[model samples]
Target: MTRETLTWLNTMTLIGHTDRRGTAWHYKASEQGGEPNHYPGAIPLKDVRARLFNWEGVHRRVAVELPASTFTEATHYGLDNKPMRWEVIGNRSALDRSDRDTGAVFGVVGPDYKIHQYSDWLLENVAGLLHDGLSVSSAGLLKGGAVAWVEVSVPENLMTDEGVEFRPNLLATTTMDGSSATVYKRTITDVVCDNTRAVALKESGAEFKVRHSKNSELRLEQARDALQIVDTAADEFRRQVAELCAIAVTEDDWQLFLDRTVPWGTKTGKPDNDYMRLLKEERRENLTYIYRNDPRCAPWHGTAHGVVQAVNTYDHHVRLPQKKEDQEPDRVSSWRTDRNLQRTVDGLFDELDRETYLDLEAVLEQAA
Candidate 1:
């Protein structure tokens, strides 16, 4: 299997989600032949420590022993005019010994890269949220422990006046793979669709990031301010939803929007082959069905908010898996899906308004 496929399978075995007040659907892992990994309510910190992030990332110097025959006397001699037998390279490898990926090398990093133990960071940063009545909703490792995340959310749910119910969560994520920095960001999960939305509003930022360096611990102390977003994200998201709900979208506009968002041709402007054409048509039909009949979207139909919700629900629950064989479906990686959803949200909202008719024309034009 490919690295991405391996990562998806590894992530599925390590992640667990809370019931979300009995609203969260069984994760894709359960549907892909694995038993459901769901907790009844907020997952206890102890449970998170024991079940998910029980291991530490250890730093080891990267080196290789060269055969004496391969080196010339002139090249192998040290500045002291003596032969050198061993030397440490400038880079180090972060290794995890956990059963999930025993002896797996998470990343190669510079000499200055600091190893941030998952359990220690959680104790310092996330343990306090529990005191404020927030509970750990989800905790997991991805990419064979190269990346790890813990989501904290309120015990109950919040609802908008337009009848959209959601839970605001603070996602504390870090990586040993150099894919991301230590980040504390706010996200909103729709109880209806179980779709996680990035809470990146234009006015107030929703995340704090700290690089993997000697001073990361100090910076984490300053990031406590970001944690306050959990208290404010609901109101900001409520306002955003209201703005979108107020914009009217006619049936014709919906069709045009779909035409531009999911066009039916190759990038070279040539028409698709028969098989590709059929797949594109099926995709469009699925989105139409979601917009008109899916409970997650129908409640807000004929509005811009509904259109966005339709696309999000499709990406989360309806889109075809990238790889499938026989009757079993391949596990879809949430990491890839989340990145796509973030881009989709940005594009759909970049110029969305009553006058624009969900303008994603610029994005599509560029892609074309």
Candidate 2:
């Protein structure tokens, strides 16, 4: 259901094959879009460990070689045990662009977007099929991996005379391909970074055209209550499960943990009072706050624990349907429930601490 955003054209489904001893297991991932879903999530298994698939025939993992450019989010689940999608902006260890038309550190793709030049005032809209598609955080390669969120940006200095580059490799650059093969191409053009774009991308717009850069909002807090859980678990010992158990004593545990953990975690580019007010008033939460720096998680965060700024609630989030004797709209608000909200929470624990007893997909990856 989620596809084609600012940079996301389609998704490539993936599955994980791992070794028990922490050895890396390479399961082939396909850049193939669409689904002939092979693993029947509906098919009941003799083993209780197996989680049934809700999107059974929707996504399947196949192994195939992709150009170095395609990227995917390291993690794909939301606070709930449901699947979510994200953009894997280029490789972490390789350069991400090529030198083409312009000469800027982040080579010119097309021309600089003239936000101020309202000369035409004509907004280009992708009509019909694209109208309903996802415009942010649409994962392109659709591969899956468990990577911690990192805080860094594409450096201007890193952009050589070539193109906008990064370490590892770039993503979604398969502009051309061989015969008999259908190639996928997604481009980021007229690239310029500015506050106006951010303002326009947030909630409340003309609703005529979809913004293509879906991942633009992944900054933080977009997950709503789900993000609060991540804030609590940021410092939970990896080799222990009790940390989460203490919080899962029923969902109320989250409210308790969040109150304790939420206030202290810092927002990126935020003053203490402002960040606190932002946390108390708004929905978009991003950038984990760091403090005096701890020993274990400190190396990752600060002396304290904080993640990225909360995601901007400017877009959509979820609202759990309330019982009202059929008096209400039957559905919750579109302000809630994104793909990220559906992914398994158990997996998150696994990512935090290997000693975690909860299996990420096991707890939440079920039929809604």
Candidate 3:
């Protein structure tokens, strides 16, 4: 195939050919060299490969999407945009495992943002807390290689009355796809159920949506308060939960609330045959069970906060397919699910006529 020039957003042009020097790729620019931090000039593929190998010897061979962030016009490679290390198969083993997977012998690797870099940031970020005896309870990469998070316990004083050990976590996600901006959120995770809710409920944390385009350095500087933001948000979350529990929802109110929050059945009060309609029924059942059966939810059952919790917990933890094939790839992810549900429910609760308290009668009256 002929080498094609891909000029990304008028920043740089990536020109490569599969037939060039037995699968070699190169880009043209006015810079002194395509090498990161070098003055602008056209650079060959050899320079990139030589620079990477000199920095570090190969440990594990993996498929890395390149040119490196430093060279790429799209990605912002900097201290904050640290690469997260990825696990790759060993040298000979990878070749033996796949007949079609020929590895790139001459390519840049180090200084490219990967998973390990993210883990390094997590380690250093919480090093002080580790001294105080808080360990990283959970940390891993999410599916599709775009998101990762690290969870750690809050201090004893921050614990709620329920004595449940809720840990606050830091999540970072980005997409090569144009659909989303690079975003980071401080969230609270219920360890028992692995359900997560963003702590940006009221602007409580370092929740930021950063453009991958330009001015990334300034944006990263703005996110320096991420640690403090999570701490403040965690405190607020505890306080809000207590306040939510104090508000009550009577049986009539609960039923009415469900009518609005999880409306099921038809005009005839019979289940709808439509699959989407039946899903609402299933959600209602799950919400009901969460309200009635979950021990954590028992105290605040039928309350405004309780209902929200039921919805969030079900959306976050409970609604899972029993089989791999049953999984809905589009919407099941924590990032997409939490964003959609939280936005929808928050909007529902924050509507103009909606008052501070969870009064179903008041809401119904307002609607009427």
C-alpha RMSD values across all candidates: 6.6, 24.8, 19.1
Write candidate 1's Cα lDDT for 1-368 as tens digits: 12334334333423334544552333455344433446667666776777667677777656654434435532465566565455567566555544544445776777767767778675456785455557777766655567677777877888999999988888777777665577777778778777666544233246667788866683445545656788788988898888778867778778878777778799999999998999889999999999999999999999878887887777666665554541244345443444333332233322222213335333324344
TM-score of 3: 0.50
**In candidate 3, which residue ranges exceed 4 Å CA deviation?**
1-137, 150-158, 162-165, 176-179, 200-206, 218-223, 265-271, 274-282, 320-368
Candidate with best TM-score: 1
Candidate 3 worst ten-residue window by lDDT: 1-10
Root mean square deviation (Cα) for candidate 1:
6.6
What does candidate 2's lDDT look like per residue over 54-149, in tens digits? 111111112222233323532444566455454433311111113222321211111211111001111111111111211111111211211111
TM-score of each: 0.77, 0.19, 0.50
- Runs of candidate 1 with Cα error greater than 4 angstroms are 1-37, 70-90, 98-103, 200-205, 218-221, 324-368
Tell me the spans in candidate 2 whose CA falls farther than 4 Å from its real position: 1-11, 14-256, 264-271, 280-349, 352-368
Model 3 RMSD in Å is 19.1
Of the candidates numbered 2 and 3, which has the greater lDDT value?
3
TM-score, model 1 to reference:
0.77
Give candidate 1's error at residue 264 in angstroms: 2.5
lDDT of each: 0.64, 0.20, 0.43
Best candidate, lDDT: 1
Q: Write the per-residue lDDT of candidate 3 for residues 1-368, one digit (tens) a residue.
A: 01112121011211121121111112224331433222122223333223221122122355433334444343534355654333343332111111123442322233332222232233333444343423333332222212233344443324577543355654443432133444556666544333455443333344665553433332334445555555566676677667665656766666777777666767778877798687777777877888788875655676655665666656545666444543666323423333332332222322211222334545546555
